[model samples]
Target: MVSVEVLNNHPTGGALCAKGRAAPEIVASPRRLTVPLKRTRPRGAADPGWVEVSWDEALTEIANRLGAIRAESGAEAVAFGVTTPSGTPMVDSFEWVERFIRGFGSPNLIYSVEICGWHKDFAHALTFGRGIGFPDYDNADAIILWGHNPARTWLAQATRIADARRRGAKVVVIDPKPNGSGQQADLWLRIRPGADGALAMGAIRHLIATGSFDADFVDAWTNGSLLVDRATGRFLRADALWPDGAADVFVRLDASGSPVPCDTRYTQQSGGRLRGVLSVRARDGRMISAATAFELLVERAAPYTPARVAELTWLPIADIEAFNALLATRPRLAYHSWTGVGQHTNATAIERTIASLYALTGACDRPGGNRWPVPPPTRALNDYNILPPEQQAKALGIAELPLGPPAKGWITARDFSRAVLEGEPYRVRALVAFGTNFVVSQGHSERNKAALNALEFQVHIDMFMNPTAESADFVLPASTPWERDALKIGFEITQAAVETVQFRPRMVEPVGEVKADYEIAAALALKLGMHELFFGGDIEAGWNYQLAPLGVGVEDLRGHPEGRRFPQAFRDEKYAVTREDGTAAGFATPTRRVEIYS
Candidate 1:
């Protein structure tokens, strides 16, 4: 391998970090797993008694055993495992791995997300009906970094934050410790761990009490004023209150303190009451007591007063107000959060609360805020529909945590280990894992190892023989990102970035008989008679399918390594986009609005 350098004038700032600079060394490292290997001994044996094997010998055995396990104990017996792409070369193969598992009819795919991107990517969907989008740093007037250290984590954002600061944007850092860019922050609060939810509630309370919130946005783009049944804690149905009202509609108290029909698409006039509980006579001859969602939110925040938050977060009232001041005054606010916020006990609550606070600012999907950067319409490859509903229902942990990862075909390490060790939810007899080092990435490492040892069969694919791979019956060599030809649809932070498409050719040859992760999955699928699902075992055909919407294929991308852009103007306030249902399409939540009470 030779030296590495960033492509000149690339959309990603044309820069490289120390890690990126070490790509050549990583590709040529002595520790690299260069060939397929088989364990001659049992999993718990002192030595695996490793022996080299051909791709056919390794993959045919894996496919045959996986099918046998499924035939004997159902598809749920064989689970898939994939490494998080954020810190690994698995980015190119993540969707492909998902496609393989779903096509194979297995509902479980174990990947550690609770400690990583779960909160930012999945938990926020509870309120917003979508994950947090790219922060529009270019036009932001106030930039809030809540437990996010872009300088150390995301160089592209660090560059954007630096440029934004240079352009006179105010900066606020809400973290317990001082990070790199915090040195220049206009306000830095050393918040107590797990108390970010408190700070968010305090901010929302301050905005509400001072009448500084975006009332129009709140009424039109959030379920804040939708009435909730006091007894059932659900949205009060209009039909329950009046004989003429429709069951599909919800009730909201208008400006005159009268109940009005509220639809899922937030198209109501901006006059809903934000506070106070009320009682109304129902058709059932019962007097129902109900409160607006905003009223409940306000009530929830009542205890999180400035003084209370100060005690809980160990920050002075002055500092707390400063934090609220930014959210109140900065109409062009942009914010980001990361692992530090997700590593706490109330991680999901913190994410939801912060999302609610941001909703009050009416900055989501708008200019100078967190805008949903539209991406290249790559036809999605992960078709879970192929996995029948009955099969999907058997996914481990789905019944217990219906809204969590299990619903999305991914399981946590804890539940996965339990399924193997105790078989409470059903035994996971076999695993086809790609690049995940769960033995170290997860908590209770020893228990995880023991569970791995108990598996009837395990196949691991990685560039190096990591701890998790060492426990597997077969360890197949996988090529690094540098040695693979990957098609990039969109970098996704801005309109320009989202419009760009690049196909990167291999930068280095594999050190030995290493195959790309997706290639390995495709080859296995061919053996498993899933040729149609994996594009007839043709990687280029799959890439072509993904590029169809762009009117470009692999051949086109191959000629444009520098990338080609499908230029289009950026659209702001996308939540208010008109829909076919003749309603102002709001957020993607069930109410088509930001959900605070969820």
Candidate 2:
């Protein structure tokens, strides 16, 4: 058992949360699985006889079974499932796992996409071409906690928020239930579930109607001036107007009420120069009235008046007005949200509208507002190109749920059950899950069980034998964080205001013969004749490869258990950098600007 000790130099003053304090008991729990177990009986047997097996034997059997299934039904038949990292560190192997699967020729991988941060990630990418980063609480004068209860969910952020409030920052909380943060909030809006989109639109309408939005930032950094055809609802391309010109160039109306080719260079310095053009006559004898993307957004949000939104969201009209008032009046306002706003069917729309709040107010990428996260320098490990296009075309849910796929082409957990049970697109004959408590973590537990039972071969890697693992054909024990040496770069919960990298040395020997998740994957990769792809089964080599871009190696972290901070400076308006052609390198979107409408 590990003992807790206080250190003066610690970031949190050596403070241990309740969960952290109980780690020893949790790790030493009787329910923890210590050995690899294989089911001896057929699928769906209530009393399936279990037999112990060595790591080598288990890995070989799993590899052979998966290989046979792939040969029979093609590699697309194999699917992978993983839970979020909140419960286990197995997700740290996500990139490597995807690499292995892509090399093995499959495109289906599942995680809690819809119920987690997928909406935030995807919607923000659509609007800003990147994920919204953490709030700059230290400099913020106003905070809006939408559907996020940081007090219970993220204590670090909660503490920072509390301190911000004590220092005169107004706190507004919007949630269905009265939470820890909500109780102390200056204003609390008790919203109805799945109505966040309406509320956000309502707030946006207020901003637009009252002329409280940051017109300068919107006109400059965003696609507010880009003209969209009224008939097609698509941006009018430069080439469409000028047949001999660049097809990718978009059009914007100048101050003199004339069409101008809006290139990347023009976008940088064209703020407030062009008016919001509602329409223009096409050169092809068509009187096409084109509206700016911002104008379209205003029209879209016009219907969500405060009263109507209050009715739809079960919020008070006064509260909605007050919330918008604070946002409009506060100079340094920051908004934050998490899973509660992302679990609904309209989660994408909701997150998009929330992102627009920051853009409309010029809060994004600004000091004391929402700052983009600086990702640690790491090599791209997901060799997604290894999978052929035809195979990738078989990924489930692309037709029905377009925004559910992440950067790595993950199949949403919401659709995993359907793909497995219905086999509408194709049959999924094999599954390799890590850290996923499928029945509990996913929606429709019965469907998940049926899908698991239907699989020709199933493997589950976890520290405990949960219901999902009991249904698997092979269950491999996983090592806990205490039993593994790892590099903790930043806090996933708080987004780490001060960026630092720390080495976590193994505190104790792993229980029984359990191995780290990466080791298991490497062993299986070797059995599948893909050892070279996995750095010849060297875990340290993989770590070094990931850190090479940062000019650090695994050995550099070995002696620095306390971690080291890189001398990086945080700057506001990071997206305002200029490109080589003297145009604005505004954002990474197609229009090279923040997308008000996609």
Candidate 3:
């Protein structure tokens, strides 16, 4: 594989405008001999051991084993898994897998959203009913770098940061360590790790105390003033929740929607250096009150002030305070990128708090500060509805199912290991994985392998032999993104174009026994005697069905790789505040109002 470092400097602007320029011309070279984790499955090596077998043998064994397990233990025993590839073209293949599992009533389709990006999604949904895509990098005045460091982790987004910097946007970085991007920041607030929510709450408090908050925006566009009983719902006084009311401490919203803060908290003493207030909002579009909102406030930031943060983070607080002051004075955009900040227990809360900075400053969904651009392959469900069908199904399951609320699919990677080991409610005896790297994706090294050992069977699909594929009971080889027809889209919201859809051709034949993901899926469906539901026995027919409603067909997309750019953004009707029943639509919160206390 090409190194990410080498791909980092690929041309941009008109240079990158060339189609297929960004992708490598070659998929991979023919591989030499490689070793496996274990030679066979009987020794308890976590995941059935690697054994060389024909594709037919592997497929037959996988189907029989999974079928037997499902027959013995019900659909809950089967789990489907996949990983995030940089340019994954087989999303629909995974979708097909999810559909099959759902069709069989399984609750084990796992994803990385909750583990890495769901906080941003939930936060954006609370604010605008949809998670904003990449930020508008070119149109910012001030940029706040929370726990996120894009320089090393996401080189694609780092280019935008460099461009934003060239245009005189003041860059401020807040992190536990002095990351590469911190060197370029006007100010670096090196506060303690896991203290981001504290810094954000402090900033909000400062904004309110200093009268810099966007009250008009809060009152008009949010649920800032809803009342609720402290004990019954997800709301309450900051003091009641935490004994150290005004001291340096953090507050949080519990599962029950109540505002609570930790005890034994003290403010970092920094000689009155950095402190302030800002308005915050919940999902129902309510703004938090300064009084009740104190739970979400940061009192210690006032004390850590500048000097304390400098001492704690080792980045001079005066410089940090200067950056903070500049951001407060000017328009600011906050970008949340996945890096070190996204791999921790506090990731979701930290991301949400960072997003609150944009909302507090009235920069959310705007031109400069974290603007959310519309997506490609547009569909209608009124404005601000981007919950794809599968996600919607998952959310509905959380709401209506007798099973406990939905597990955090995106955030709970470790739990997968745990569930496989413990099998509390039911055993996750079988795992069907595609392009997933267990060692790379999970942390605790020993536990991951052990969990794999505990599984009754492990089926992996991939183009090349990977750590995961080498450890599987069955390895179903998969095709490359280039060696398959695909509909491609990007999450980047940028300057040049709007909602471009492209098609990629199968550049080469399959290597060895490899097959396109779609083909493998259809074949599996056929083997399972459910061929009609999978693709109606024709790949092109399925593709045509997916494209017909868009007024485009397979022939139109064939032979053209650059694809077409749809002209107009779909203009949907405005969303209503109240339902037709004359009653309010309940917020996801227990009280269903914009939660000020929470």
Judging by lDDT against the true structure, name the best candidate.
Answer: 1
Question: Per-residue lDDT of 115-162 in model 3, one digit per residue for the tens?
Answer: 455556554454344564556677888776666676655555667788
Which residue pairs in model 2 clash with each other? 265-583, 279-289, 279-290
Alpha carbon deviation, residue 160, candidate 2 (Å): 0.9
TM-score of each: 0.96, 0.94, 0.74
lDDT of 2 by residue, 1-598 (tens): 6665544343443345556667788678788888999999997787879899998889988999999988998987899887676535754666666778788888888876667877666777888988867788888989989888887776667877888999999998888878688998999899999898898898888888888888888878888788888888888888777766577888877776577787754545464332365556565877787877887888889999888998899988889888889877847887788888887777888888888877889988887888876766667667678788888777877777655673355887656777788876777888898778888777788888888888878899998888888889999998877888776555442334245667678888888988887788778888999978888988788878877877988788889777766545556787877567766657888888888888
**What are the runs in model 3 whose C-alpha is more than 4 Å off?**
1-26, 32-52, 85-92, 123-128, 153-155, 175-180, 189-191, 231-315, 332-334, 376-411, 495-498, 570-597
Worst 10 residues of 3 by lDDT: 264-273
Off by over 4 Å in 2: 5-18, 242-246, 267-279, 492-498
> lDDT by residue for model 1 over 1-598, one digit each (tens)?
6777677667775667766878888888999999999999987789999999999999999889998998899989998889887767887888787888888889988886777778888899899988888889999999899888777777777888889999999988888888676776888889998889989999999998888998888887788888998899999888998888888888888888898888765464567776658898888888889899999988888888899999999999999988887777746988899887987657888999999999899888888888877776778777778788998888888988788878888887888889999997889898889988888887789998988888999989998888899889999999989889988777756778888888889877777999999999998888988988888888989989999987889998888888888876668887777778778867777777789886
Q: Please give the CA lDDT of all the candidate structures.
A: 0.85, 0.78, 0.54
> Would you give me the overall lDDT of model 1?
0.85
Lowest-lDDT window of 10 residues in candidate 1? 265-274
Candidate 3 similarity to native, TM-score: 0.74
| Model 2, CA-based lDDT | 0.78
